[model samples]
Target: MRKKAVRNQLWVPIIAMTLLIAGCGTKTEPMVDTAAGSKQQQSASPAPAPQTPVETVELTISAAASLTDALKEIQTVYQTKATSTKLNFNFGASGALQQQIEQGAPADLFLSAATKNMKTLVDNQLIDAGKQKNLLTNELVVVVPVDSKVSIGSEADLSKPEVLHVAIGIPESVPAGSYAKEALTYGKLWDSLQSRMVQGKDVRQVLQYIETGNADAGFVYKTDALTSNKVKIAFAVDPKSYQAVEYPIGIVKSTKHGKEAEDFYNYLQSKEALDVFVKFGFTVPK
Candidate 1:
């Protein structure tokens, strides 16, 4: 009876040991599966999303040649502020630009040095009359080469014998030339100066003539004369001599980007743009 009792005690211990071993194996297998699942989830994480691009709109502006310097500065400011819109400028004589618009050239806006060109466009329905406004004013001036020795102090001096050739823009197309003609006519010197006049396609060309010494003197806007180191202002024509030198801006009737063009047009009247124009010798409209 003592031997049988000892055998029963040994069997109890063996059964307890077997049950513990089986529990450990089951728990370890589940732990290994859980660790593998965590690694797979980490490896399958998605990449960051791409950023959206900004939408950009481009506009074309047909402007008078005299606005070249001021508009270039304004363009820099506009681009910095209005990031979504880009301005492309087409600078030329207002009459030439008017003809181009009449011929169906692609332009979003028109900025004229004089109202006559604007009037022609308005008369032909090429511009939005409702959107038109005179933005600035300018003065007519006589310019001589930096090294000129002739005593030219007024429009009357342009007919002096020492002044061999005088440069002026074409009166039929360039507003500056038309103003020059009016000033000379007001002074009663038109016929006397006509024989010595050298005509250019635009005001810039007139300025170029004086700069290169191609002509003894030239007529240009005060703003145009201010841009050059090679020319000196010989005199400012009396305000009474010519009509008001007004600059008008308007939206084109055929512009596809009317909203953008209008926005830019309004921006030109802002203090920032006006400051630039003033720096370049343009006078703000009252």
Candidate 2:
């Protein structure tokens, strides 16, 4: 009976340890599986990538019609350096463009063919005075049709009674016309040729009249005369006869892209752009 009691005590202890180990093994298996699942979930998830910013800038430039070729060339050069920027150009008579700026058009830059139109903006405080700079110079010339026989030896030829329908830009609205008026006054033909004047909106328009043979003769800039193959250059007006026809550029006070506008303005003075200007028949500022 004592031996049986001893065996019963040993069996009870062994069974209790076996059941406890089994419970621990079951709990540890579930914990190991849960830890592995958490690691897999963390490894499978993806983090967000950083984003890149998009840069864009638009610059609007209002310039004279005569500058069409030169400015377009400059624009091509400018855009090459700053591919993210867009250039917008408004070409017309200086007086007309000045009026548009004065009316609060969104203009980042102003390039005028004449100082008079620039002065209009300066007087009104529409342009930054410190940012203004003279950029180019030009000379006026007389143009006639290729086959015309109007023997225009001097200013006196324009005063002949038969010289009817002489084309000139409207003196009040065009710089070329104002220069022509000064030339006429200095040559003593302003009064005699006043009645026969056929006024045009701009020098380019006056050139058109002569090219179409609708007018006997017209006054335009040497640069303007070079643009057309149909019109023959008769004579270049004396540069000393009138005030210097200087082209000026300035940053508008209302510019949203003032820094970029100034960048482009500085580029105009660079040698690369000046070469283009020279190729187009404009005298670059020294």
Candidate 3:
């Protein structure tokens, strides 16, 4: 009886230990699973805060007719770098462009062919005067149709009898016209050529007249003359005869893309854009 009781006690302890081991073993996987689940929930439910969407800005630029090509080329480079920006350009006579801006056209940038127009904007506080920079300079040239046999050697050649029709931008509004008048007056031919002159609203219109053979000769920027393969350059007027054609660029005061606009204005003075302007017959302004 004593032996049997001792044997029974040993088996009781063994059975209790076995039950404890089994209980621990059965809970191990569930504990691990619960820990893993908690980690997953923490990772999956990160934060309720919303992320900001990338912004897109539209910048409107009112520029002189002469900068149409250069601006277009520059826009390509700008767009490639600033993928979220959209550049829209309105090219016209400097005076007209100023009028548009003054009349509440949504312009982020203003580029004038002459300082006179830029001054008009500055006087009205439409642009940030402090940000304005003189970017380029240009010279006036006389252009005739490629097939025209009109012999033109100098400003003196403009007064010939065969040069019946001459196209010029309206002197009051167009910077090119202002430059043309300055050249003609300095050469003492303004009065003589007045009778044969056809006035266009803008310099581009004058170019159109010559390109369509509507005029025997026309006065335009050297850059414009270089742009057309059909028009032959008769002569480049002496820079001394005309007021310097300096192009000034500035950011509009009310621009929505204020930061981006200034960035692009800075880019204009970059070597990449400057080299392109030089290739198209424009000189860097001093």
Query: Whose lDDT is greatest here?
Result: 1
What's the CA error at residue 179 for candidate 2, in Å? 0.4
For each candidate, what is the lDDT? Answer: 0.93, 0.87, 0.90
lDDT of 2 by residue, 86-105 (tens): 99999888999999999999
Worst 10 residues of 3 by lDDT: 25-34
Cα-based TM-score, every candidate:
0.87, 0.81, 0.82
Pairs that collide in candidate 3 are none
Check candidate 1 and list the clashing pairs: none
Candidate order, lDDT descending: 1, 3, 2
Per-residue lDDT of 1-286 in model 1, one digit per residue for the tens? 9999999998998999999899888844334687888889888996678989988999999999999999998998889988999999999999999999999999999999999999889888988789899999999999999999999998877777899999999999999999989988998988988789999999999999999999999999999999999999998989999999999999999999989999999999889889999999999977
